[model samples]
Target: MSMIKTIKSLPMAVAAAAVLAALPMPEGTPIFGEQTAFAQRAESNKKQSTRKVQALTADFHKKLQKAQEAIDAKNYAEGMEILDDALARKANDYERAVAWQLKAQVFYEQDDVRGTISAYEKILQFADSIPEALEIGIIYNLGQLYYSEEDFDKALEYIQRWQNRVDPTLISVSNLQFIANLHYVRNEFEECLKYIYQAIEIGNSLETVEVKESWYSIALSSHWELGQYEKVRDVLEILLINWPKPRYWTQLAGIYQELGDEQTSYSLTEAAYKQGFLDDNETQLVNVAQIQLARSAPIKCAWILEKAFKENRVEKSPKNEKILGQCYMMAYEYEKALEPLSKAAAGDEDGDLWFQIGQVQMQLGHYKDALDSFASVIKAFEKDKSEKAKEKTLSATMQRGQAFTELKRFKEAREAFKTAKRMATDRRDKRMVTQWESYLKAEEAREEMLNG
Candidate 1:
């Protein structure tokens, strides 16, 4: 199967916001903070050295408060003007960082992502003056902002930086998933698998957590990109268990087929069909029927096709009709096969389908109908000079003789056998024709005795 087609079939989130939303935010912190708390705190235990807490100047504090009030009132332009004036006053690192933080809030409120990114970048320039937690949060937000901008390389860079600084145990499943998706968009399948597995593991361990469906989708797609069929199958099975959607079932079946496990593939496809998952999918329905026929479940194949035809799900084209007829014939449902076979035969220019129709009619003991089918076959091949056509014409004539014999029409049977003998180039065909002629004589004798 083409991975591109499979990828296209998967239901996945298209928005970068979905990726951002999937990440767990700090307990009370929004995904994108409008304001960073300027009050300083001690560094985390993971940090070797604690940075000194920086306090905002009383004058700058008053200015920042005024800016916050304007922003809160939705007077964004007024808020930006005050912050720009405060920054122009030659503020210290701490005061400058605080001013930029308020500026970011204004830009964010204005829905200016680029402006917000610029303000946040300025705050990072005073990284040492800001609290460690606040700095880390800014880094994480920058990654998400870059993602929203579709700058995947920068997004991965900043997110990885945040991951390096934070405690692994504190990372949420959604955060891991966000990182995994970043790797996925970068076409780094191996890296994507690493983070996705971590996310799944974390998600599984938490009793209250329900792993997001997109997490498994990423795993499945990554494994496929890496050519890991077994892992892909495993992920698909998990997805089927948790989600139980039609695409998962079909995708898992396809994986099994790629692994050369046709039996399992057929079983999955048949199960999906039984659940009516394949009903709305015309190609999948036909595929399931074909698999059934290949697996020697001709009756099931015939029934499926028959129902699909009635429901107008599958097209009633000549090729499809022939398949339906063949399925019924294979299952020894000769009476059921006759109609489709005859319809298919009528649509076909070559006499092959007509020959099949004649054979089915013979099996059903409809010798008169069989004779007519054989006549049609002969007529179809009358003008064709191909060797195969000649062979088929000869076989039809011989069957025509048998049909006449079954009807006790001894004179017509003799003529059919005679014609067959003249057309026979092979010694075996000649011998068969001679035997039919002898059978015709016995039929004549039997008929006479019965009449007496």
Candidate 2:
């Protein structure tokens, strides 16, 4: 089975917005809410320490204010120019960090991801001088930026750096899921499972939370990749309860089959079919039919294939027709078997199909059709000198003699028995031919007596 590839990571804008929301706003800028945890901690430390906090110079502050106004007005180009000019001047570490922060905002406004990442990395260069809250936010935002750029390795690196600095209890479910997604994309299944299970456990523990479907999806794909079918089945059961998508139902049924629970597999697949989930999937429909036939429900199998054929969902290829024909024959629906059997027989080159068709014709007492079917079987093997082919030819000839006898064509019956005797190598086969010849003579004499 192909791995499910859906991911539910936050979009770049949303991730960036989250980072921007958590950090301290520039001077004279509007604060959206309370200060960040790191910001509050830094403020408390500042109060306890005698050392002075670094401040931006008046000239640098003026340029920063001008850039912020241009940005607030949606004048991205002017905002970028002013931030670039401020960064060009020789400034203190704190001033450079603030300028880069404003530049990152400008790049973000212009939807320039590379520029945004560059600006954020520039701020990180001043990590020792910048506020702890600002530095941590930049690191986390860089991870999200790299992810948006599809640089998964760099994304994971930066995200791990951010995680190390933050308290373990402060990490949210979304952060765990994001880390899990990074691991999944990198093919680190074991690590992916570790983080995903953590996220699932945390989310499930919350009274008001509904776990995201994509979390279970990641677990399902991770287990499948690791060849842990039992775990995959467990995740799929949860998905079926919460999501109940058609794909989840079919995939769960497949997982049951992989785990060697054929009975459960059949039951689940049949249930999905009853719900009309398998109607559009021809291969799966045919698989369910095969399982039904194996479980001795040939009538059910035939009904499925017959319906599929009528709806044009399944191709009426010789192989499919042969399966349908066999299903009907097993169910004792000889008359219904003839159409598909004849079509399948007509397309076969090996004569085995014709032999089966001949048997069905004999069951229906259609001696002429049976005679023709047996003749085709014999003709199909006439050129093959293999022992298996010769055996089939001999069997067809014997059946043909019976067909002729039933039609009152005693002369043809005698010729067919003569042909069979020539081909019979086994003592048992020779004995059977002898018995048939004796019956032919007795039948011929009985007919003569009746005519006289």
Candidate 3:
């Protein structure tokens, strides 16, 4: 009953890469409180104290400028060392704070995350009191770093806190973009839609294509997840108006499938296949056949598969063969089912296909053949070396054993049930074993009575 379909959107990494241009700061400062802080500093300073602080600030400023020059030349270690010496020297609180900010920027540029975080933490602790803008900017950068690390929880923690500090009406598109991405990463699709829509609303008022495209991307994924097929169709109609591509065809086909509109799904899928939207040429042909079969159009299904085979489009894939077998079974061509069913059973050697083959054989009145097929499936499953497989094997064995008992093969049936009892670990299987033990005893008693 699951309606899960192929993802229409790119992988998170690709989407992340694609939306980079929409992001505001990327890895830079979020705000600038330094100008206001400088104003306050000027107002509060006495002449003598201001003179001493200004001289120290001038020296630190010169050292910071030289460090920037070194950094520009790609001598990061040398630049950081010079900045370190400046911070270590006769520096007041303000100079030390600016030196830490420079140090953080240098480490961020060098992609040393831990070093950058450490320096940023120092900047926020000391500089936040003097410069609120720098504090917000540092926190925003921390959000970016956490996101890069794929740490959604920490990223949200920082970004949400930053959002709380900033005015919503004044919030930049970049901030909203990061928040939307953070929500997407956390699978909080609802929150993601809210923010992305808000960004779109804001962008529409300003008429920015950047935010419009972001809106389209969000709408596509959100509608798809919510199974709003009509909305998906409508949005895709608009998308194709601008970018008429095969991507929409496939997505629309899947959505139609979810809506139980078989003919439309079939039509769209065929169009996609013909247009080379389906890369697996043979598999796509078979998929079209499956859609027909699901619609009770087995004749159409058979024709498509036959054409696929004749054109060398079909691979000798187990999946394709299984589909072909099921198609033949539905068409009441049990004889035709034999070859594909046998091949599939051998290829997978799994319990399900074996049971399927057994069912087909039984329908054809080949009871002994059915018994053998089911037994093979049971034995193969038992030897699979997987605990879950073994559990499945036990269930298959029990079913096969019951079939044998009904066919009056009591000895084999008893043996199969006994094997199931030994292999089974689940409570349900244990109860089945107990029931079969009583059945086996009853069968033995009836045989004894007959002989007596």
Best by TM-score: 2
Task: Give one digit per residue, the lDDT tens place, for model 3 in 1-452.
Answer: 11111111211111111111111121332222123222332344333121112123456667876876787678988988998899878876656666676676666565566676677677666642343443554566667766766677987888887777654555656557667877887878788878877776776678553554556667778767776678888777667666667777777777777878878888889878767666555656778888778778886777777667777778767777878888888998888887887887788775778877887777776777877887787677765788767766776778677677667788888888888888878788889788987887787788779999
Which residue ranges in model 2 land beyond 4 Å of their true spot? 1-53, 69-75, 348-350
Please give the range of 10 consecutive residues that has the lowest summed lDDT in model 1.
13-22
**TM-score of candidate 1 on Cα atoms, chains taken together:** 0.73
Index of the highest-lDDT prediction: 2
RMSD of each: 7.2, 4.5, 14.0
| Candidate 3 local distance difference test against the native | 0.67
Off by over 4 Å in 1: 1-48, 291-295, 345-351, 362-386, 393-452
TM-score head-to-head 2 vs 3, winner: 2
Better of 1 and 2 by TM-score: 2
TM-score of each: 0.73, 0.85, 0.57
By TM-score: ranked, best first:
2, 1, 3
lDDT of 2 at 14: 37
User: What are the per-residue Cα lDDT tens digits for candidate 1 across 35-135?
Assistant: 22211111333553456745556677678778878877899889889988999896788778767777776666566777777888888899887566667
